[model samples]
Target: MSDPNANRGLAGIVAAESALSFIDGAEGRLSYRGYDIHALARHAGYLEAVYLLWYDALPSAMELAVFEGTLAGQRELPAAVLEVLGRLPDASTPMAALRTAVSVLGQVDPEAEDISHEADLRKAGRLVAQLPTVIASFDRIRRGLEPVAPDPELGHAANFLFMRTGQAPGPTAARALDTSLLLYLEHGLNASTFTARVVASTLADIHSAVTAAVSALKGPLHGGANEKAMEMLLDIGSTEAAASYVDKALAEKRKIMGFGHRVYRTEDPRATHLRRLAEELSVESADTRWFELSRAVERLMLERKGLHCNVDFYCATVYHALDLPVDLFTPLFAMGRTAGWAAHVMEQHMHNRLIRPRAEYTGELDRPWVPIDRR
Candidate 1:
C-alpha cells in the first residue's frame, strides 16, 4: 500500500497523450480532431464529427455519402443479440445492458477480436454507427415494446430521437441532441477511455476494451452524473426549494452532482454548450420551470462552493425535455462516446505498448505468516 498522502486518485497526473482532441481546462477550450467544438456543435452534424474523429479529417461530399451509407446499413442489431436483450430484466440499467450486449456481440462476430488497421476500422465504424441503435433497442425491448428500426432517411441525431419516440424531432431538439453527442464524443484519458487503453495495451480485442470502458463508466463520479443531476432536480421541487435544499446539502458536505470536475477548475467547456442548449430547449419547449430551478441551484452552488455546473447539469434538463428516462442518461453518454472509445482503442493499438504503471509500496515486507491453527 502507498502512503495515505500518496494521492491515489492520480490527481494532477499526466497519464497519456493524444492528437485526436485537445482540452485546455485553464483556457476553457475544447477541440475535436482539428475543429473547434463550438463551431462543430453549432454547424456540423453528429455523423460528420464522428467521421472526422474516426478518419482524422473532414469527409468530402462523396466520402460523406459512403460513410453515412455504411452507418445506415449497420444500424440493425443481430437477432441473436436481440434475443439476449429480450431476456434482460426491464429494471436493468441501460449501461449494464449495454456492457452485456457489447460483450455478447464479441461472441457472435468472428472478426470481433481483429485489431488490424483495416479490420479494426471496419469494426469500429460498425460499432460507432450501431451504438445509438443498440442503446435504443435495449431501451425499447426492456419496456416490453419492439425496437424501432433506424430510419435511413433521418440524420444521425434525428434518427436516434425518432427511434426512441417514433416521431420526428423538432429542429431545435435535434440540434441539441446532435451537439450533446459531439460534446461527449471524445476527451483526454477519462476513466472509461483509460480503462479501454489499459485493456487494449494487454493486446485484448476492441470489444473487450470497450466492455471494460463501459464498466469503468458505471461509476457515479463519471458518466452517471447526468442521471444524478436529474434526481437532484426532482428532489428540489422548485426554484424556491432549490435555494434551501442546496444550502442543506452543502452543509452536509454532499457533492452537488453535475457541478465541479477533476481536471477543469474554472468550468467544463462542454457544459457551456450544453447549458446554452438546455436554456434554448427550455424556451423551445415552453417548460421553463426546470430551467428556473436549475439556474437557482447553479447560482447558489457558485456562491457556496465556488463550483459551477458541468455538462451533466444542463444535459439532464435537455434529456428531460426530450422525454428520456433519468436512468438512460449515462447510456446515452456511452452511445455518444462509442466512437471515441473505438478511436482510443485504435490509438493504443497503433503504437502498441503494454500500459504498466508502478505503485510505491508501503506494506509490511518479508513478514512471516502465522499458521491459521495458531490463532
Candidate 2:
C-alpha cells in the first residue's frame, strides 16, 4: 500500500531519473546537460542552446552550422497547415491555435507513425524549427496581414521576430529574445515536461507526445502565468500605482501572478537575466515606465511577503519592450520550451517505462452500491 503521508502533488518526489536538466532550488540554480544556464544565456545563441538540450552536448562549429541549416530548411510550413491557420477565427487564442496547428502537423507528417529513436530525433528537429514559424504566422494572419516567409539568413530568434513583424529585428532586440529563449528552454520535470514524458513512455510518436505537452502547458498554472503577469503590469499602469495596487491585492489575499515559484526559494536564476534585459530594453525604447513599475512592485512584494520575482515577472516587461502582442506570450513560451519537451520525450523513449502511479483512495471504503432506480 502507498504511504498515506505521501507528498501531495508529488512534491519532492523523484519519479524518474533524467540527465536532461537539474534544478537546485535551495541555491536557485539551474543547468541543462550539466551546463549552467547563466553561461548558456550569456554566451550561447538560442539554436546553440537547443542543440545542447537535444544532443546532450554542445555542438562543434561545423556540427552547429549543419544543424542550424537543417532547422532553417525545415522552417517553411506546408500549404495545408498555412490554410488551417488562416481559417481559424480571430477570437482563437494563440495557444489554442498552436495546439490545433501542431495536431494538424502530426496528421500531415509522413513519418508521424514512426516510433524509432532516430525518427523521433528527426521529428524533434522539425518541431524545433517549425514552432516559431507557426506562431509568427498565426499572429500575422489573425491581424489580417499576410504571413512573412522565413529568412534563410537569419538565426532562430531574429527570424521569428522578422516573420512576426515583417521586419528584421535590431541586434539588441534579437539578442534579448534569444537570451529569453535560452532561459525558458528547459527545466527539471516541470508539469508540461512531465506530461511529455508520460506520453512518450507509452511508446507514442514524437508528435503525439509534443501535442500532449502543449495541452498541459496551456493550463494557467503552467504556461499562462506570463500572460497574467503582463496583464497585471498593464493594470498597474505606472510606478505610482504599483505599490498601492499590490497593497490592495495583498490585503484581499489575491494571488500575485509572478512573484512566487513552486521550486525556487530565492529569486529564479532566469529572472536575473530577464530583469537586466527588461531594464536594457526599456531604456533603449525610451519608455521606462513598465520596468520602473515592475521594480516598485518587486520592492513592495519583497518587503511584505519576502517572495522574490520569478522568470515571468520581468519577462512581461521584456516582451512589452520588444513590441510583442501580450496574447502571444504563452505561445512564445511554448516555442522556447518545445526544445525541452522534445528532449524529455526522446529521453523517456530511450529508457522506456510506463509512468503509472497510484492514488490513496479516500472517498469510500465500504459503501454499498446504489441502483439506478433507487427510491
TM-score of 1: 0.96
Task: List runs of model 2 lying over 4 Å from the truth.
Answer: 1-6
Q: Which stretches of candidate 1 lie over 4 Å from their true place?
A: 1-4
Estimate, for each residue in 1-375, the C-alpha lDDT of model 2 and write its tens digit.
677777988889998899988899889999989999889888999889888888888999999999999999999998889999999986899999999989888888878998788888888888889999999999999888999999989989999999998899999899999899889899978899999999889898888888888889887788888889999999998888888899999999998888898899998999999999999998888999899998998899999999998888888889889999898888888899998998888888889999999778867587788998994
lDDT of 1 by residue, 1-375 (tens): 436667678776777677789888777788998788889887887788888998899999899899988888888778888888899876788899989988887777669867797777888877876778878888888777888999988878888888887888999988988889888899879899999999989989888998899999888899999999999999998898888899999889899899998777787888888888888998987889998888899889899889878888988988988889998899888888888998888888898889889877767889889999996
Candidate 2 lDDT at 119 equals 86
Considering summed lDDT, which 10 consecutive residues are worst modelled in model 2? 358-367
| Clashes per candidate (backbone, < 3 Å) | 0, 0
- Which lDDT values do the candidates have, in the order given? 0.86, 0.90
Model 1: worst 10 consecutive residues (lDDT sum)? 1-10
